[model samples]
Target: TRRHRCRTSASQCSFCEEYILWFSIAQDILKYISPRDEIKLPELELPNINELKQQQLKQQQQLLQQQQQQTLLQSARSSSKPKFTIEMSSGGDNQSTSSSLSLNNEEEVPANMNTIAPVPAAAVAAASTTPELKVENNPDAGIWITSQGVFYFKLNTLHIHLQFFYSVLKELDRIIDIDALYYLLCCLKLLILNDECLETAAKDNRGFLSYCLEKLLVPHIWKIFALGHGHLNECCVPLLLHALNYEPGKTALWNILERDFSSAHWKVRSSAGTRVIALYSLLKPKLIKNNYNVLSVLAYAFLNLITSIEDVEPTVSQKAMCSLETLGDASFKTVMCALEFQFDTVINDRSIILHRLSKLYTILLRNNSTIKILSWEFFLNRFDTLSIESQISMEESGELISPQSIGGFNTESEHFIRKLNQIRFAMAKTDSIKPISSSIRVPSHQRRTTTTVPRQTNVTSDKVETDSIGSFLSPETENSDRSTLQLLVNLLMKFMMKDDQNQVNDDRIMLKQQVTSNI
Candidate 1:
């Protein structure tokens, strides 16, 4: 009963009057720390190893006696010191002896070299005269190396797992070489548990990681950044990031972000930051969000992607970011929209897609950006009715729970709440910044650049065009319902896609008609 009562920690004691004696024993075995205490390493007293030395000395004495007896018997008939003494007797001058010993004095010489004396002339004659037989166990002087898992068998070192990627690169049959790259990615994912190891891996992966980073992870993120697609097979980005021990995305993942990611793309190689953001996004990028340098790069990366590229993929990135805002509860839709700056023709379709934007807000819940995004009142309006009891059922069935509707109890929304919540030190910076509504505005040229009611992109058209952003909603939405603005934008994008499909079908029809006419 007493033993059962003692459960968790050895430091605490569990006792009743019935178990007083057992409690006393537990107290003796288990020590408790007081608040003021600074526990030191236990002073353990191990038996002195001098006894082993003594035993060895005794064996050596017996060996010496036996040798001497043989020597005396042999000397009665002949005479000689042993063979090693002879081999060491390279009898040049004292200069040669000094030189041999002093050779490579980068470190101290072996002790035995100093102790061994020159061989007697008789010992030299022992081999030359009668072919002296010699034997030795070679127990005293040498090192033994063996492999234990990923690391060399060096018990003194604290390294738990260490293996080079190159070694594994050369595959051998039936041998599983340690994958340092995958291992490192794992280390990064467990950063919360192994932060020290994560940092170490970023450094160790410097050489080979670049090759994989460039060839694999970089492309994946860029595809996601610019293209918004990735295959979750073989090596998933999550697995790689986990092994890297990088914090979850948005936690400043760029700290371990590869500088060479740009080498894979002409655009990336053209500007290094482009590749980094692409690569950064692959690790889910939430890890490195706290880092100032990374944050700046992220901002720049967003600008480069949408402004210059005229493709559906750039729109995908914007869409993904909007979804991302949903995870964190922040409204990065504006920032993502801002990245659309500098585009030559402000394609009305690409300007905004409400479904995509709403998706961004949802994914925000999953990103490090989630908490920051959620601070807005816009998000709070979604689900305001459920109590805690209903909330549990909602979670069980994979139902929805909007951060906003959790009660809408607050007087002020997230934007206003956070503005004042910022540190007093940031007052100056805050004062200089304008509200999102005030700063964001469409340009006159942006209005002028509008083409006829944007139509769906007809890729099937034989007419060659360098670029296109399928058709979009009409400009007439200027008078549309404010609540439906998002829906209007989304519907336009859908229309563009549908137009692309129709163009493909129409081309098939015209081709069929032409073939029949020719026949």
Candidate 2:
């Protein structure tokens, strides 16, 4: 009949046939990918639910029959007991008579009574009690596979079963494919964004929230970087930003951005800069409030932004500048203070300091309001102080250091000074205060001595020249100069030494010629 129905509705049955084929393929694939230990055995048979039910019913019936037989036996034993007994004269005679009477009664009982013994208490209880059957309904019980081949759970159900969500996180960690991991991240982001209940659930389960924020999302940022680029801002950044809805997530994000901003990798720094901008934009409403806690967070963020403005990477620098611009009036003092601190601290790389100074000068030039707020006099004093220190060091060293040299004369410093002079001159024209001299003044005693030593031998002269050149050059030059000086010194000493044997021979020849002339 079923075959006839299928034949009559072939078009309707085609969909079912196709679905069966697809399901079979999926099962085969699952079997192929599954571990060897999990492989199924064809010879093993699974018990049917109906068979199990029937078996249970038969066992219960057997228990009921046994219980009924025990009850009948117990009643028969109670009724068959002797109602009255006859006694003899003496004690021994009475005992013998009673025993004979019990024996006679036992022999009179039916032979089937031998099989009707008392059942154990545990068996009786088992026979009396019935097994309870419970049915459980779980709507979100299975793994859901999407069209993209990503497996996930329903967002609405994730909050209900947190362990399943954690398992998803674990699976996400195991995924090596970038696209698959990214799809999973997108699903998580959707779960966070769409499920309003998750927030309350996360609040209730702080461990779950912390695990997702710190363990799952934060680590994935670096993992994504390690795997590939171009997806961080799209996949991880928005997810982290959205996660900032929770207080713990906000803290985690702050730590992440802070650590990444100073990362050794430029890519991490650039991404961090971009994240900071997004974070500020997202928190701007709360940041603008007069709350101290929020304001403190803003201060730390602004400090990181200011520090990034001098980043060697142009991407990071531009992002920092854009973030600062977005911050506008709120970050004015923080930026100024941070720049001041950076300028005061002498870093080994003068170029970085110069870069930061140049960026700040550009900002002041672009924004007139910034110029009004900054004290150009203080900067002039600081610049002059640094210039004097550099001059003293240069004069003491007695070598003309190149402006481009690290930890040496910084041309950017002079350029920044000129810009500061222009700003000072422009500002001084309005006020009566005289423009301070931007030129660095070296004390007469601190000046480098230029006295020349008298020229010695060629080797000595060469040694002096090499020494002077090597002093200003890098360490490699110093090594080469030392080697050359040793060679020249050894050659000069060899040339200056006399050959006593040859001198003695020439003296003897002179004496022989004189004696011959005399003869």
Which has the greatest lDDT? 2
Over 1-519, each residue of candidate 2 has an lDDT whose tens digit, in order, gives 012234554354664455445534643553354333411111211133345557778989999999999889878877885544434334577776777678667855764254223233344344446544221222244322211121223445445535544554566566543444555564554444444324645655444465465556655654554443455335554454445444555465456655676577777766655655544433323223322223333344554555665566667667667655655543454444433332332222122333333444446456542322233233333444344434333544675452222222344565434433332322222221111111112223322243111123333544544433234434423443343343333333432343345544654575455434433
TM-score of 1: 0.24
lDDT of each: 0.32, 0.44
Question: What stretches of model 1 exceed 4 Å from their correct place?
Answer: 1-196, 199-236, 239-300, 310-519
Residue pairs clashing, model 2: none
**Worst 10-residue stretch by lDDT in candidate 1?**
143-152
**lDDT at position 45, candidate 2:** 18
How does model 2 fare in lDDT?
0.44
